[model samples]
Target chain A: MATTSEIQSNRDLFERVARRRRRQHAEQTVFTWLLRAAVLISILTTVGIVIILVSQSVGFFAEVSPWEFLTGTEWAPLFSPQKFGVLSLVGGTLLVAVIAGLVSLTLGLGSAIFLSEYAPERLRRVLKPILEVLAGIPTVVYGYFALTFVTPILQNIFGHDQVIVFNALSAGLVMGLMIMPMVSTLSEDAMVAVPRSLRDAAYALGATRFEVSTKVVIPAALSGIVASFILGVSRAIGETMIVKIAAGATPNLTLNPLESIQAMTAYIVQVSLGETPQGSLEYKTIFAVGLLLFVMTLAMNIVGRWVISRFRQQYE
Target chain B: MNKQESIINKRQKLHAIRVLRDRIFVVGFALAVVVGILGLAALLFDVLIDGLPFLNINFLSSYASRKAENSGILAPLAGTIWIVGMTALLTIPIGVGTAIYLEEFASKNRFNRLIELNIANLAGVPSVIYGLLGLAVFVQFLFNGSRSVTAGALTMTLLILPIVVIASQEAMKAVPSSYRDAAYAMGANRWQVVKAVVLPQALPGMMSGIILALSRAIGESAPILIISSLVWVTFIPTSPDSKFTVLPLQIFTWVSQPQHSFRGIAAAAIIVLLIVLLSMNGIAIWIRSKYQSRPDQ
Candidate 1:
């Protein structure tokens, strides 16, 4: 019914709208792809780390047998005999981790209990930030504290002859302090997630505060608490500066905390700090050690996350 | 009558014991907090006391020295600034973009969940392991065995990316869905809604997260220690590729020294580093509180 000129104008307007819509669709597609690329970079980083670790570690294991690297008691890769015993380093790492575990569990759990159960909201707000401040303090600063202050205190208490200047005890103690906030925060979250009805029921049954926290709340939050402890252990094992500075870098095969011991992280730092050329066995050895450290921590992290997720699923 | 009286006495005794035990537990718990606070206070006191004597303009301005008395933090301080700046530039875009994609664009599917899990795991990876990755990937492969500032910055970018992404995601999540719906109702596209409505609400949170991450990057020593082994750097870094050291590494170097005088200088450096970190954290806290309070109005 329209005139020819009017019909032609109408067709032109429809085409322009279609063109704009197409352009908008194209823009969105491009933007979405760009975002997808951004996400891919994170996955790529993990891939890169794995590739670098595995390829170079292959070079290391080529020269040093995997069996010897696993079972050897000596870790002096740069020494005359060139022993590649990783167990010594693992032993030292475990020793420090165990000590740190004890300290963190006792102190961190206590703090968690107090914060979740005992402290008033106002006090909790103040205290939690203060505790977190400890977590935020640089580990290198903690290393310095361990080397200078804590070591001296230990030496004074245990007698200067008993505690060496670079004992694992000081390093482990400071590492515990560094990791305490994590344990406390995670455990506190778990405890807070526990139903208030549980606490109310306990109170109604005439259970004392201590009994309720220990028997009712703790049992309920056990998985989460265990997760916290595992994560804390992983952290302690991966910790570098505190051990590098405070715990001596001598790879000794001993379970004694009072002795100077080298941790796996410290050995990595020691080698990296040195001018070891790229592709050298010494450099490659660090990669091998790194692989071990990575696998250990990754396993612990996975287990911890699984436990936490399981615990979360329970309440959900 | 005797048996009933005995039972009553026994019940009272049991109640008293429980009360005493509860009081002990309370005291013990209170003592735990005191111990943590006291430990922090002691560390602060020790550093301040040791480092305050050497914290002068000269200390800030001078470079490293063979003589402990003549040493300053100039070179390493400059290095820290360059690395952190480059790290921020590299991290903020990618991290925020990744966060945006995950929160707004990505389909809620198995693949996205896998990426999320990967990121969470990466966050738990040791900083030093990242150092190893940096040493291998950046320093060796990319730079051909050059421990340049660029390599260090890139390495640091990887180290903090997970954290920034996580934080930004949280911020974006905190933006109510209503904002998006309102924007969409007005004929805005998804991008437009996110750009205009969601971002404005999330910006303060994102900024705080970035600041906190930067503060962490500033304090990190292990990764840098492995990346930059040039301990005696006496000149300021002029470019990203310039061989450089950072404040934490410098502190590590000074602390490692057996010389009694280096400890004072190390403490001075610690004081400077602490001030930078604490100020950033304080700013972040302030911004978060400000934004949090505004919604009430």
Candidate 2:
């Protein structure tokens, strides 16, 4: 029934549509592949970080026995006798982390409870941003604050002889303040996520506001709170400038927060700030220390992720 | 009757105690907020008061000197600018592109989940570890032990990449799926839909996120310190290979000095650094609020 000329025009239109669709399909595939490459770069960065740390660290281990490096109590690699025990640094790091943990947990949790439970929406909106300003400050500035202002204040309280100029207390305290926002924000999110029914149920039982918040809301958000604490500890461990400037570079094996100590990060900065030649044992010590720090933070991060995901699954 | 009276009296006492406890808890929480805000206020006040005396044009323009009076932030400030500029150039495309890939293109499968996990982990890695990576990979291996500005910038790029990627991904995810659906209905393919519809909506978010991340990079000094230990840089860096120092690093050097005068100068440097960061953060916040308040298309 179709005329020949009409059939030819119809065929031409079909071909054009097919061509455009094919062109589009081709373009989509190419663009998708390009995007895949972009994703691959992130994986490559991880691999690169591992390779660089391990390869250099292997060279370091060959120079110094791994057992000696890990178990040694002394860490004065640059000084005479060249001791390379990493525990002293680890001890100092943990001391600071413990102080930071206590400070941030108590203060941060207190603020989070208030913000999530007590404060009205309008007040919360105004206050939370102001609190987050603490997180935005540079660690270096905090370091300066810790060294000049906080140390003097601590000395005034503890006596000048008790609180040395570069003791770990000031650094730990400031580091806690630095990480408080992270704790408060994440914990507040978890607290806010707790079902209102739980609170109502507590109220029905004649529970006070404080009792309900502490007993019901906090327990419901326990996993998230734990995750925030772990993440905060991990951050405290990795913090460099605060410890470097305020916590002195003396690698003393002491638990006293008032005593000057060198954190693992501070040790790396100490070595790097001076001229340690490449391939030397002292230069390679940084990579080794970095490896230890990487493992510690990585473990905490993994656990934190697991805890958060598990918590989400429960609520979801 | 006597037992019941005793029970009622005990309940009343317990209730009264709980009420008092609740009041105390409220006061304690309020005090926590005060401590946080007071800390911030004290820090700002201290920096302003200490640094105000030394914050002059000469301090901004001159180079570092052995003497506190002659030392300036010119070299370090220039270095910071160059490093951040190059860092932005390297990060924005890769970070945004990766975000697009993960959000729009990648199938929700095991492999994609791994990449997601990898990015999250990378975000948690310390800035100083990135410095060690730079020291090993970029400075020593690539540049033959030269602590060049290129090395520092590349180090910073890696340091901030995870942040930028995460922020961009958040932005891309926030773009409504309806826009994509509308584009697809118009015979646009996946790439076309994403390019034409999703990006415009996400651009404002992506820009703001990148700005915030860059502001963080500006304040970061640890990685730069590990990479470029040359503290007394007298001239501004001209090229990628030139030796450099950044604002925080310069401040660190000055702060380490025991001299009282050096602290003043360090405070001046701190002011400059704060100004740069605060302005960037303000702009980013402004952009976010502006776009967020606009009516949907």
Q: Which pairs in model 1 have colliding backbones?
A: none
- For candidate 1, the per-residue lDDT at A203 reads 98
TM-score for candidate 1 (chain B): 0.98
Q: Report the CAPRI category for model 2.
A: medium
- DockQ of every candidate structure: 0.78, 0.77
Query: Docking quality tier of candidate 1?
Result: medium
Task: List model 2 lDDT by residue over B1-297, tens digit each.
Answer: 999999999999999999999999999987888899899998999999999988889988899999998888999999999999999998888888899998988899999999999999999998899989888889988999899999998888888888888988898888888888888888898899888888898998999999988999999999999999988999989899999999999999999998878998898899999999988988998899889876774
Q: Distance from true position, residue B82, model 2, in Å?
A: 0.6
Q: Candidate 2, after superposition: displacement of residue A10 in Å?
A: 6.2
lDDT of 1 by residue, A195-283 (tens): 99889999999999999999999999988899999999999999899999999989998977899999999999999988777789998
Clashes of 1: 0
Off by over 4 Å in 2: A1-23, A311-316, B294-297
Q: Best candidate, DockQ-wise?
A: 1
Question: How close is each model in CA RMSD to the real structure?
Answer: 1.7, 1.8
- lDDT against the true structure, per candidate, is 0.92, 0.91
List the candidate 1 regions with Cα displacement exceeding 4 Å: A1-19, B293-297
